[model samples]
Structures are given as C-alpha cells and as structure tokens.
Target: MLCLTAQSALQGRSDRSAWQYTRADTPGTGSVRWLAVTDHFHGEQVLRIHVVAGPDSPSPGFPLPRAGEVVASPAMQRLFASTPDDQLDDRFPGEVTGTIPVDLLSHPEQLIAVVGGEVPGMFTAAGIATSPDHAFFAFARIIVGIAALVLLVPVAVFVVMASRIAAAQRERRLAALRLVGATRSQTAAIAAVESGIAALAGTFAGWLAYEGLRRVLASSVTYEGFPFHAADVRAPLAALVLVPLLAVLVSVFPLRRNASKLPTAVRALPLAVGIGGLFLVTYTSAAGFDELAALFVISTVVGALVVGPWVCLQVGRLLARARSATTALAARRIEHDPKASFRAASALVFAAFAATYLSGLVSAYGDLPGTGIPPGVVTVFDGRDREIVSDGTMADEERIRTREAIASPNAIINTRREFVLRERRLWDDVESAVHFAVTIVVVVAGCGVAAGAAGGVLERRRSFALLRASGTTLGQLRRVVVLETGVPLVAMTGLGVALGVLTLVATKGPLPTPGFAAVVASGLAVALLVAATPLAVLERASGIDAIRPGTSA
Candidate 1:
C-alpha cells in the first residue's frame, strides 16, 4: 500500500547520474569509477552487466545481476510462477552479484528470487514479478482520520454553540424590529441574513487557520509516510450553515415568548433567557454527548455568568441575616432588587469560571499538584484557587528543617532527580516540579475582571444616569463603578487563590514557589479588576446622555 502511494511522490523516471570507466585501464589499480543509470520510476527489475577486461587487464569477463532482478532461464521462470507468495520466501537463494557480494534488497516489499553469478555459491533462483506494496498511503490515511477527529470538538464548541446562542439573541432583536413596523417575515429574513453573514465570516477565518496548521504539519511530516492534504472545507462550511440554522430554530420559542410580553416585562427578558439557558446547559451536561468535556466546560463558564447575580444576591442576604447593619442593608437591597444587583454581579461569575478553568488547565500542564491551599478550604471557599510560581531557588536547609519538624512520627523523605524544560532545553518529565500557579491565577482573575466590567456596565445603566444627574462628576461615577466591581473581583479572586492553595495541598501535597506566587498575584489582580469595572463604565457612559435619547449608550 505504501509503495503504491509513494509512486506518486517519486521524482519520476530518469536514470540517475552515474560515472563509469573501462575495467582494462584500472585492472591493476583495482578501482571502480562512479557510473549513472536511469531508473525513471524505479520500474526496472535489474541490469545485466558484463565487465570485460581491457588490453591492460585479465582476459576473462565478470557478470552480475541487480537486486530483486532475476537472471533465470525459461525453465526457471516457469517453475517459480507456480510458487505461492507465502511459500516463495524460504526457497530464495542469496542475492547474486559479481564475484564479490552485497545485500541488494533493503525493503521488505521488494522481495523476489535472486539469480545469476558465476561465483562458487552463486545460483540462479526462480522468481516472478508483481506490483510492490504501499505503506505510505495507509499510514497517511490513519493520520488524516485522527486529525479530523481531533478538530471536531472545536467545531462543535465554536460553530455550533455560537450559532445557538446567536439564534436565541436574534429572536428578541428581530421581534423588536417587528414592533417597530417590521413584518414578521421581515424579521425572520433579517435573522437569516445575519446568520448567513456570521457563518461566512467564521468559515473564512476557520479556513485560514486550517491552512496555516496544515502547512506547519506538512513540514514536520515526511511525504513518504503521512502526507499532508488540505482539510476539506466542505465539512466546515456545512457546520457553519447547519449550526446557525439550528441556533435560529432554538431561538424561535424564546423570541415568541418575549414578543408576547409587555414592554415592562420585555425589560426582564434577559433574566428569563438566562434562567432558561442555565437549565438547558445543566440538562445538556447531564446527558452524555460527543465532546462532553468541552461542553461541560463551556456550560459551566456560561452557567457561572448567568447565575452570578443570583449568587451575589444570596450572599448579600446571608450577610444581612447576620444582623450587621451595614451588610444587612446592602444584602436587603440586593435581594429586593434582582435586576440591579443580579446584573451587576453577573460578571463575577464569568470571572470565576474563567479563573477556575484557566487555572486548572495551566496547572495541569505540569506534574505538580495545584496551589498549596488545603482541601478543607473548599467547604468555605468553593473550589477557586491561585496560581503557582517558582522563585528559581531551592532550599536544602528548609527541606531538612521541615523533615525534622515532623518528629511526632516517622516520615520518610527521599530525593529523586527529575528533568524539566529550561529556556533553551527540551521538555522532559521530572520529579522536581515547575511552578505555574502564579500564571494560572493571574489569567483566571483577569477573566473575572472582564466579566465584572461587562456585567456592571449592563446592570447599572439607570443608576449611573441618576448619579450623573446628581452632580457626580464622570471621574466620581467611574470611581463608584470601579468600587462596585473591584470589591467582588477582589473577593472572588482572593478566595480563588486560597482555594487554589487548598487544591494544591489536597492534590500535590506541595506548593512550590512558582505556584504560590501565581496564586497570590492572580487574587490581587482580579480583586483590583473587579474593583475597577463599575468606575470605568460609569466614566465612559457618563457622556452617553449627550447622544440622541434612543441611541446606544
């Protein structure tokens, strides 16, 4: 199979260059000059050669037959033709060359009877010729199949999920167009148009990425084995179209539901969609599906987003019940006004999910456990954690001291060598761990900041308007916004760090410096980001009143 496939990639039929000299001139020298032979497509069986002595050398001539090329009489060919493919292997004699000998056939697929040399051991062997085997093609097919399977998850997550979410949003957006004088058919048409545009754009981008990856893989893989073929665009195009259509269909019910609601209730549409989305995700996760892991990850992050406000409200309520005047007032206010409180805090959930997953994945990159927090902390802080860091220093004394500190019981400590990738070195598995906690922590916390910002801006539009009217300068308004978001960002990130530490302790039983630093930094950054969001939004939106009343702020 491979040989057949490799034929296409061969340089083609041409006798490769070789040099030759007459044997007579070099007889005493006993040296052979280079010679070239043409074997255009490697189609030749063998070359029969007669090396005659020149006037200066011996008179006799020597003859040799090429590898896998048999020099058999008519009777021999007829005799071997009857031999089965399996049985012929044991009957073949050694390769026949000139007086001296060398192994000629290297490939397993090229086996054929050996023949023709006048040397004492040389004997003509009967043989038949058949098409050579192909291994390259078969191997390439397997790799292509695996690559296709690997891409399915991304396609489902990005293309399918995006379409569904967009479809849900389209219904409401289109219905709004209808109430404003657009026809129902027109609304649907607009949705179709939107989906088509989105699909096209996404497909184009996906193709570019595919081509880039294909090129990269091609350079690394030898065409003689697994050849690189451009991934078929048809599948991805179909995905773009089908996913969006399904998304649109999914949105139909929600759109209809919201369209029937009075404008007052229309204001609550986001909440309803959010709640339904939550249930949908939960249900989907509970059911097994292809790429279930990715689905769970996405759903968990989204779930966190939708449920954040509710979570905050609940927390506030808990605080209120503790009979602390300040916290109680705040909690009651949050609980009583779901729209305002929930929307603002919704971003926190995004941050939290982002933080957790990012941290988890980054930490997973190494063999070490996560951050150094104990497992018991989860009962208090959920499962958030910090990133790990390495200070590039190892303490032999500290290790000894810690060992001695455990005097109450006998504990065995053994040191083992491990390989780790350095700046210029290759990666290796090692007992000594690299610290990634700090990086993961920071990344996760950053996600929280972004979510918090988006949520705060969305939730406090009216409040911000009021503040602007009440003589709050844009700077002050922005400050207030930041204060609101930053608080939650900090709190959650801090908790995440602690949780990260706890996770490490629970899992790795060690918190290396790198991991510890990552967690601490992550917590601090997220906290600051959370605190900064409201203020930033308020500052930006403060100027919105200057626009036409209906224009987007």
Candidate 2:
C-alpha cells in the first residue's frame, strides 16, 4: 500500500494555474513560463522541469525563491525528489528559459495529484494508473504478495506444531474433566479458549511489529526514485479486526481432525484427472488461452495436496524392503502414518514448487530484446501552436524550425534505445525482488522443518529409548531418524519439481535447470540437518528412563 500510494502521488493530475505561461519570451507582468522535458537517465524515466523567469515575474511566496524549485513542499522535495543540479541544459534560441517564480508552483495539498502530462497507452484510476511509474508500483506489489504467501506456509506449520507440542498434557486434562462430568461440548469449548488465548497473544505481538516496520518504511526510500509518506502507511480497519479473528479460528479448527482416518485414494484420483484435463486443454487450445493457464496452476496445487502422501507411502514401502535395520525402521514409521509426515512437510513442498515455477516464468520473459518503431513511420506531437519532432523522416531544417517555434520543446530520435532501457529496468527490479523474497521464505521453512523434527523425536522418546537399550547403537538410531525425514522430504521435493516443470512446459516457458537444481539441493540439505539434530543430542545422553510408560523424558 505504501508503494502504491507513492506511485499514485507521482502520477496524479495537477491543478490549473492562472499564472501559467506557454511562451518562453512572454514580457507580460506577473507571468512565468516553464519547460518540462522527459528523458531516460541512469536506467530510469526522469522529468526535468526548467523555469523561465521574466523581468516582471510575480513574487514567489516563499524564502529562497530560486533555490531549487520543489514539488508539493520543501520538506517533500527533500524526501522524494533528487537534489537539484543547475548544470542540465536550459538553452532555447531567442527565448528566456531558466527559473520560474515559486508562486506558480503547487501547494502541498494539490501536489499529491500532479503528474505533468498524459502517458501513452495507459489507463487511469483514483489512486491507481497504468503507466511506467505505475508499472514499478505494480511489480512491487506482486513481490510483496509472493513473500507474504510464502511466509504463511511456515507460520501455518508452526501453529500446528505448537499446538501438538503439549498434546499429551491437553488430552490428560480433558480426560480428567470428562471424568468429573464435563460434557464433550464443554471440553471442546475449553480447548478452543486455551488455543485462542495463545493465538491472540501472538497476533498482538505481530501487530506491534507491523507498526514499527511501517514507521521505518514511511521515512525511507526503497527504490531509487520512490519515497513513502506517512499517509501511505495506513492499515485498514477491517484488516486489523480480521487478523486476530483468523488466528483464533486456525488455532481451534485443527484440533477437531481425526488423525486415524486416512485420506482415500479416490479422493486424490479426481484431482490428478483434473490436472491432466487442464494440461490437455492448454496444449490443444489456440493462443491466448489465459483462463486455461490459470486453471492449470490451481489444479496443480490442489493435486499436490491430495497426491503427495500417497507417493510418500509408496517410497517408504520400497525402502522397507531394504536389508538395513535402520532403513526398515524409518520406512515402517512413514508407511504407518504417512499423512502426519506429509502434513508436517507440506509447506516446504509448496514453497519449492512456487520458487521453481516463478524461476521458469522469469527466465521465459526476462531476456527478450525490446521491439522498436518500424521504419518509414514518422511520429509527431502537436505542440498546440507548432509541431514537436518525436520520431522519423523530418529533415534537419524542419526539426530546427519546429524547435524554434515551440516554447517548451521535446523530441524522441532513438525509440529503440528507450524501449530497451525501460524493459531491462523492469526485469532487473523484478528479479532482485524475487531473490530477496525467496531468501526469506527458505529461512522460515528451514526453521519450521527443524522445529517439527525436534517435536517428532520428543513424541517418540519411548520408542527411541527402547531401541537404544537393545542392541542398536546410537549411530544406527541416528541414521534411522535421518532416513525417516530425508526419504519423505526427497520424495515430496521430486514431486514438486515435476509439477513445476510440467507447468513451464505447458505454458511454453523455458526450463530453469540451474534454479530447479538449486532448490532441490537446498531443500534436501535442510531436511537432513533438521533430522540429524535430535539424534545428535540423544547420542550424548546416557539414560533409558524415557522408555518407562506414562513418563516423559
């Protein structure tokens, strides 16, 4: 929202001024003429406004009249605009062009709606527009949205894992209340209140963090030319109310699930069929089948949710046939409760797939050369009294005559260079933002994986202690835990990569080989480290008291 507001302010319409003058040589009293020219500078679009002060120009209402004119107000100029440089060209033959009377400049309130002129081929709206300036804004929004979605995966996983950490205690308490004549509904209500309280506390902390971040953003410039204002950092009232409500609901809902009831093969088969159907439609349809493309993405994600655990179970069964006792033990655990394993790792699976898909999308569009205006086409802009040379076919004499006739002149001689620069800047910004978001996502996912692995080990303290008391060595027991996590994680990652590749192929995008390889490698490494950590701690302990019934170690 901050980005959107800044861009909107930069592209809004200006109010009409009675002091405005078009001619550079106007000698009338209380009149000031300004020349605004647009050009590309340092890989960005820049508008340079030159002031032409007359002998009888009006008094500028502020102090330091000619000391670098500003948009909105002096403070805003320091925050949003680049420092003024007097070195830029202001020469116009037979005309006086230098500095405008400051009285003609916009006041603070009017400056918020002051984009100088119309941009070609753009749609306009109340706080939104479709121009080059707005393009950067749109791209920024997309980057932030992707990051938020990726972050949600780890947060959701953490919530579920946290709830389960005290499951034994919760169950015992509920059982006691039941024995004392508590109804099932009453017990469920009590559990809901407990979970809701924790969630509400976390939500409050998150709200405070958001406010601090908002303040920092308002005072800083993120991109080269965009600065956020205090007005841009407003949080919607509805969002503030909804956040805590959502946290409470998510905390209580998962507790009602019946873990023993396995999801049926029939439930997943239809999703596979739907995905295949979408792929076929996309391949067979004519060009510009955007609806089909969107459907394919939705189907693929849903299909992963449905089919992922089945694949994990099959892989576990194959590993169970191995002669190694550690591998067999790991495989049996996964085969016995694949759903639980899948639930713990599903977020990682989704994040990997999203990263791969986005990589391919970027690779497909990022490198194409920009197209230019065709030959033999002359482009001219009407400057009201005279013409302006924008592109093509005009002789040198004609171009010079047109420039001399107009008060504020501009031209576009090389369209190809401008197009290329604009396209390159757009893609560079997008890729940079994506890389940053991906880094954040990977870190969060790694933490969740580690926490889940530790929780799983704690839950199975008795089983691990029994194995350790028997003939099993600590190294063997550790390998078992590693296999338990590593196998399912590797299986899920492979499935995600396959789905990503299929999407790229269907959309006629290039395969991102290096990116896919990196995602897969990193995911496996994180999973291995998470699994090994618990066993490494167990190896140092010299007790078997964890195997005692009804006791927690």
Candidate 3:
C-alpha cells in the first residue's frame, strides 16, 4: 500500500507536469499586456485586482468564461461592471471581466519564470511551490521509492511471523497424517488448500480495508495546492495480484520447523565488524560517509538480527544459574528452543534500530537556522542582498529582483521571517514523519509479539499441561513465561537503542545528542507491552484437556 500510494502520487505529478508543459506549448492566440498588479481600494478591504492592458475584442489566449479577453478576479469584474468610468483609475486598462485558465494558476512559479515579469511580494502562493521535481524528478522518484523499501521490511517481518506461527501448527497436523500412512503429496495438497483459502480471504479483506480507508481519507483530507485526486491513489494491478500469491507461498512453505538446537554465537561477528566500521569512520578522518561507511552502518542492524537468537541462548544459560526457580525454568525453556524465544524480538529489533537512528537523525539535523544576513539565519542566495536588510526588515528593497524573478520584499522569501518559517516547518515535518514511521514499525512489532505469544502457548500446550499437572502453579508458569521472554525483549530493546545511538554518534556529530530518557522510556514502554502479550493466553494453554498423553491439540 505504501508503495502503491507513492506510485500514485508520482504518476499524478507526472500527469500534471506533462499537461502543464503541453498547454504552455499550445501557442495560445491572446494579445494582452499584463500591467502592474494594482491593489483596489474598496472601503477597508483590500481586493485583488488583476489589471491587463488589452482591447475589449476577443482576446487571443484562452478566453475567460465571461465575454472579456483577460484573466482578472471577480472583484475586478464587479468593479468594471458596476463602477462609473470616472470613479475608477483615470488610466484603467480596458474594462475586462474573465477567468484565467485554471492551468495558468496551477503553475504560477513556472509561468512567472517564463514570463520574466515582476512578482508581487504579497503572495506566497508560488513561493511554497518549491518545484521539487522540476530538475530532479528522478531524484524525487528515488526518494519516494526508498519509502517502499523501508516499509517492505515491516511487511516482511509481519509475514515471517505469520508463517512461523502457521508452520508450528502445520507440523503437528501434517506429522500426524504422515504417521497414518498419508502420502507426502496428500499432506502437501491439504496444506496448499488450507493456505490458499485463508490467503484468498485475507487478501480480499485487506483490499477492502485499504479501499475504505483511502476513500475516508480522500473525502476528509485536503491539500494546500495541486490537489492530488483520490482516483490516483490506486494500487497497481500487479500489486493486487501479488499479495495473495505471496501470502499463500508464505503460509505453505514457512521456515523449516526442525531447527537444530545449535548455539548461534558466531552471528555476533558481523555486529563486531559493523561497530568496527563505525570506529573507522568516526576516528580515521574519513571524509563524508562513503558507501563503505553506509555498509558499516547497515551492518550493525543486520548483524543484530541473527545475533538476537544467540543472545537469547546466552541469556537462558545465565538465567539457568539464577537462584529463582521461575527464572531457572524459563531459562531452560529458552535454551531448548532459542530461535523460538527470539522470534518476536526479531521484529522489535527493527523497530529499535529505526527508533534510535531516526531519533539521532532528528536531533542532529532537525534544526539549521541559517547563518546569513541577520547573522543567525542561513543566507538566501549567498546573502548578496545585505543592503536590503535594515532595522530587521526587507523594507529596503520593496522590489527584490533575482535571476528567478523580480520578486517583492513581501513575497515568500529565503530571508528573515520566511527562513524562520521554513526552519520551523522543517522541524515540524521531520518530527511528524519520524513519529508516523516509528508508530507504524512499533505496530508491526506488536503484531509479531502478539502472534508469537499465541503461537508459543499453542506449541507448548503439552508442556504447559505437564507443568500444571505437576506441583507447578499457573502463577509460577506465568512468571516463567515473563522471565524467559521478557528478558530477551528488554535486552533486544536496549541493544537496539545502544546500537542506534552509537551509530548516530558515528554518522552524525555528537553535539545535539538524542534524548536518552525519552527514547529509552518509549522503547521500554513498547517492549513491556509486547512482553506481556503472552500472559493473555496462559489460562487456556494450561487447561486439563492438554494433559492427555497422546493429544497434540
């Protein structure tokens, strides 16, 4: 969906650009000299008056809806229609009443650039239109394309979790059928049918949900300019078809169930190398973060992924030596199946990595109040217009002309308050984007945690029954679950935070550090919530019926 939305936005932008450029090349037949935009005096209110010097005959360019050959505001039309000729400006350009082609208004900046005319200082409409893709549409595509890649990680995590959960259930059912002399193909066919039905249903449901949410958003939300029509927010047909196929494949061919109970300590090697790379970049007078540095930065997170299971195994060993029986029991369980113990934490590792890195990024670059004409702000166009600054105002140059256009001092500028506005807006946008992305990742982690919790109980039902049948109480069992799972969850969260902060310091400077308290608190808050999810299914898992000797259910 994220990729689809990005595709939609990019396609919409392309269509608009092509249409605008096409109209620009149309060689419209209009003869009108645009005079200075004159402000009209209608009592107290300031009305926009677009006065053009042209004859009342049919104008050459796209004519307005009314019988005039010019494009002026309705107020101009009213004034021209009702006011006496003597009352108006003695040199009023001809009396014209018409609307400009909507396309002309849409590309104010592009048109202004082409027109080579004076830009009124009062309007910021074109100023906000930064023409992000005018020269770098490919760059825009890459940036948005990166979003698809980033989001795919979470979606992949979710699918892996779902498949792992399904695999556990399939193992029991299929193993039983095999024991009863069922052929391998028969079991595979049955598995395929089950997966196919569920995948189809789920895919359809997801599509419905996406469509409903998009419609609601389209109706309620509005854009500042270049309104992106809701119709453009469509997923490609290929994406729609791919979803079900991927889901079915994931469900039917999950990771192998018989994972060898071997300690995966070697997984930590990459983590060491990644950190070493960080050190090399940080201390070796390395210039900018090169591709090598980037690889190192990424190595830290990827290394953490496989290392988590090993960490769990070691944590289990240490817990086994603890004085508390609950801890010992939990530790033993984790030692028995460390991969299972770390499954959910895998999801969270990604979240933690993102949280810490993003936090560092925001702290480091979120604020860049310029260092220019005003001495504290970034300069606009190399600060050549220092003479324009007087008493903290752009008032010196009422008409500031640059290569771009003859813009007025009142226009949305790169100096003074406008710069301040941009700085503030940048901070806000970065903060919001980070918040949204983090929230999404956290939610994805939550899904994994929830599924892992439920799957854990179901897989270990017989053990839960045995424990309960013995002298072990449900309370102790709960403690064991929390200790075993919660330990790894906390450790993974802390590891993620540590690695994130360290990487941040290495890549970005350390002057503006990430807020340790907030980041830690938030990560722990989410970790604790995930850790508690297992307790929700404890009672049902340890039921009396699960104690039956031959029952796999």
Candidate 4:
C-alpha cells in the first residue's frame, strides 16, 4: 500500500509544470490559505491544477487573470499578509522588482499582484508549482517509503508471534490424530482443511476492510496540498488473489513428518555472531560495507527476536527449581513451550527497537539548515548563479532554465522563505508518518498480546483449577500468569531498546539524543499496556469444571 501511494504521487508529479509564481502566506491559519487556493481552482476562475477524469469536465478552463485584470476576493486576499517590518527587504512581497527565475518571483503577472499588495489566493496550473506545495508530492513519496520500512518490523514480529500461537494449537490436535492411526498424508490434508478455512475467511474480511481503508486515506491524506484520488490507493490485484495462498503456506509448511530441528541454543550461535559482527564493524571503519552492515542489522533484529524465546526457556527452568509451588507452576509452564510463552511480547519488542533506532536517526538529522529564517522573509538570488548553494544552503531548483531566470545574473545570500516553508512541511509530513507507523505497530502488537494472553488462559484452565482445588489462592494464580508473560515482556523489550541504541550509536556515531530518548520512552510506555490485555479474561478461565480430571476441555 505504501509503495503504491508513493508511485501514485510520482505519477501525478510527472504532469506538473514548473512553478511560475510564489507568495508568502499570512501569519496564521495556513489550512485556510491552502483551502482558499483549492476553492479558487474549483470555481474555474483558474485552470484545473489536477486533471480529473470525466468526458464532461472542462479542459484548459479559464486562465487566471494578471494583476491588472484580477478582481480580488476579499476572503482570499486576507490569506496574504505583507512582509513583517522587522525582516522586510527589497524582494519582500509586493515590493520585489524585475523578475528572477527562482521561486516567488518567477511569474511576472502573479509577482505584480503580490507586489501590488491586493493578492488573490489564486494560482494558474503552472503557478501552483511556485509555492512550497510543489515539493509535497516528493515529500509524500519519501514519507510513505520510510513508513513501509519502519512498518516491516511490526509485520515481521506479528508473523512470528502468530505462527507460534498457531503451532502450539495445532500440535496437540495433530498429536492425537497420530495416536489414532492417521497417515501422514491424511494429517497433512486435515491440517490444510483447518488452515484453509481460516485463510479464506481472513482474506475475505481483509478485502472488505481495505475498501474502507482506501476511502479514509483518500479523504484525509493530502499530497501537494490536495488529496489523492480514491482509485489510486488500491492494492494490486495479484496481491489480493495471493493472500490466502500465502496464508495457507505459512500454516501448512510447518507440519512436516519426522521434522528434527537443532536446539535453540545451537541455532542462536550464528545469529549472535552476526550481531557481534555488527558491533565489530561499528567500532572499525568498515563504512564502505554498508550493505554488509545492513545484513548485520537484520541479524541483530532476528537475534533479538530469538532471544525472547530463549529467555523464556531459561527463566522457566530457573523458576521450576524454586521452592514455592506458584513459582514452580509458572516456570514449568513456560519451560514446556518457550516460544508460546514469549509470543505476546514480540510486537512490543519490535516497537522498542524501531522507536529507539528511528528516533535517534531523526534527532541526529535535526531540522533543515535554513529552517530558522523568519516567516515572511525570502532571500533573493540570480537564477544562473552556480554558487547559489555555495554557503551550505539547499537550492530550490538548480535545473531551472526559465526566461526570467536567464535574464537575472545576481545572487543574494540570505535564506529563501520558500525552501524554509517546504522543509517545514516536509518535517510535518514526516511527523505524521511516524505517528501513523507507531500506531500500526502498537495496534498489531496489542492484538497479538491480547490473543496470546487469552489463548494462554484457555490452555491453562485445567492446571489453574487443579491448583485452586489444592488450596492455591486466586491471587497466587494471577501472579503466576503475570510473572510468566509480564517479566519476559519487560526483559525482552529492554533487550530491544539496548539493541536499538547500540545500532543507532554504531551506525550514526552518536548516542540516542535526549529528544529521541523521550520519544522512545513514551512509545515503550504505550506498548507495555498491551501486556495487560490478558487480565480481562482471567475470571472465566479458572472455572471449577476444569479441575475434574479425565474429562477433556
């Protein structure tokens, strides 16, 4: 979905003409100003900025009038405020002289309207490229691409967690069939039927949900100061068709006959070495092997994931040695199935990893270099000057070859307001993308924890009832549950944070900054709350009937 959105943004951008004019907005209510621009185009007083499909819709509508002919709408005119007195300059709106090729002064007629000081918030199809909005499509594309990468962590976590839960559930059922003289092929067929039903049902529901999701994104998310078309947000047809097939493969592939796997400790050695290699590369100057470093990062992530189950196994064994019955009971259960024990924490662990690493990178980059310029001030420059960005500032458009730009040869050194505004918008979009990514990880993780906890409750009912029948208190049973899942969540999530901070410091050459620390801390607190979802089902799980032995649940 994210890749498709990015592609759609680029496709839309390919049709845009270079900006011909630019204007500074009033001090506040930027949404109103942008909306005013939207309305002006909608009224056909100016040409359509985006060509919408329909045989009847007018093509090449009215051209926006020049300064002398434009009748300013009072509401739209208020969207422009003159440059402030403190930062005022010769190129200040309504005061700028003969045209220059770059932003704000590129369009003569619109510049005249701005210079004359009764600015209408109107834009020609070409003039729309003049404002900070011109780069919004590119910004949106980058944001979605980053979001996809960030979100992959949570998706991978969920897949691993869900597979653990499903495996545990199926093993007991399939083990019974093995005792009944069921052939291997018969068992495989049975497993396929069970998993197939679930896959088909889930795929159908996902298809339904995607339609609503597409509508919501189309309505609420904007690029280039306008929302994208609803049709552009769809998943590929191939993806929709393949989802159930993939789900079946994930569920059925693990049902192998005579499958023998190495002990997790032995399996963990290579992963650990990969992580060690990451730390070694960090301390050494192996920067050119960034691709190898990326592989190391993957190793680190997978190692952290594997560590959760290993921790559960060790803790269970240690607890099983305890004198207290409750401790032994909790510990033995985790020991019996360590992967299932650690499943609930996987999402949260991934969240911590992502938050710590991504926030560290974001903090290191900081705001755009010239983002500090005053709101109304726009530094001028000669369009042809090759040294426009020689002072370490970002260039607006180095390839611009407009006639006005060619006529002007002088370069001014101050920061341009348009670039400042564009960078700010870019930052705003990034912040929104981060929030969206965090929410996705949290929601997916929350569901995992909730399902894992509920499944644990169901699976342990008989044991809980047996303990209670033998004088165990309800409080003690709850403690057992909490210690089993809760401790691993804290311990494993901490490991994730440790790994994340190490990766960030090693790769970026700085410790996680204070700003990133706060962000990661806040994210961890929210993710930790998912650990409590199991408490909601505790009351029903310890019923007395489960204590009556020899009868199946």
What lDDT does each candidate get?
0.36, 0.53, 0.56, 0.51
lDDT at position 153, candidate 3: 66
Candidates ranked, most accurate by TM-score first? 3, 2, 4, 1
Runs off by more than 4 Å, candidate 4: 1-232, 237-308, 311-328, 342-351, 365-372, 375-379, 383-417, 508-541, 547-553
Comparing 2 and 4 on TM-score, the stronger one: 2
Give the higher-TM-score candidate: 1 or 4: 4
Please give, for residues 345-368, the per-residue lDDT of candidate 2 as tens digits. 676666666767777766665666
Q: What is the Cα-based lDDT of residue 548 in candidate 3?
A: 78
* Model 3 RMSD vs true structure: 8.0
- Residues 128-245 of candidate 3 have per-residue lDDT tens digits of 1113235556766676576566656656656566656536668778988999999988887787677677767877888888887765544333222223446655777676667666
> Which stretches of model 2 miss by more than 4 angstroms?
1-37, 49-87, 91-147, 177-297, 365-414, 513-516, 519-543
Q: After superposition, how far is residue 502 of candidate 2 from its true place, in Å?
A: 1.7
- Estimate, for each residue in 353-399, the C-alpha lDDT of model 4 and write its tens digit: 76667655555446555445533322334453343332232222222
The runs of at least 3 residues in candidate 3 whose Cα sits more than 4 Å from the true structure, single-residue gaps closed, are 2-4, 17-135, 166-169, 175-183, 215-232, 237-239, 254-256, 286-295, 365-386, 390-416, 508-534
**Tens-digit lDDT string for candidate 1 (1-553):** 1111222222110101001112222323232221111110011122222221222322212233433333332323443466442223112233432232111222112222323222221122121111222464456456445433322322332333234432333454676888899997777677667766666676568566655654443333332222232221113245445545654553333422221211132333443444344444445554544334354434434544454444444555565665544344335544555444333233333333333433444444456322221212101111332222223223332223233212211122211111121211211111111122233333334444444354535444555565567676665555444434444444444433443344333333344346445555555565465435445445555454634355333
Instruction: Give each model's clash number.
Output: 52, 4, 10, 2
Instruction: Give the per-residue Cα lDDT of candidate 4 at 135.
Output: 71
What is the model-wide C-alpha lDDT for candidate 4?
0.51
TM-scores, all candidates, are 0.35, 0.65, 0.70, 0.60
Scored against the true structure, residue 238 in model 1 reaches a CA lDDT of 52
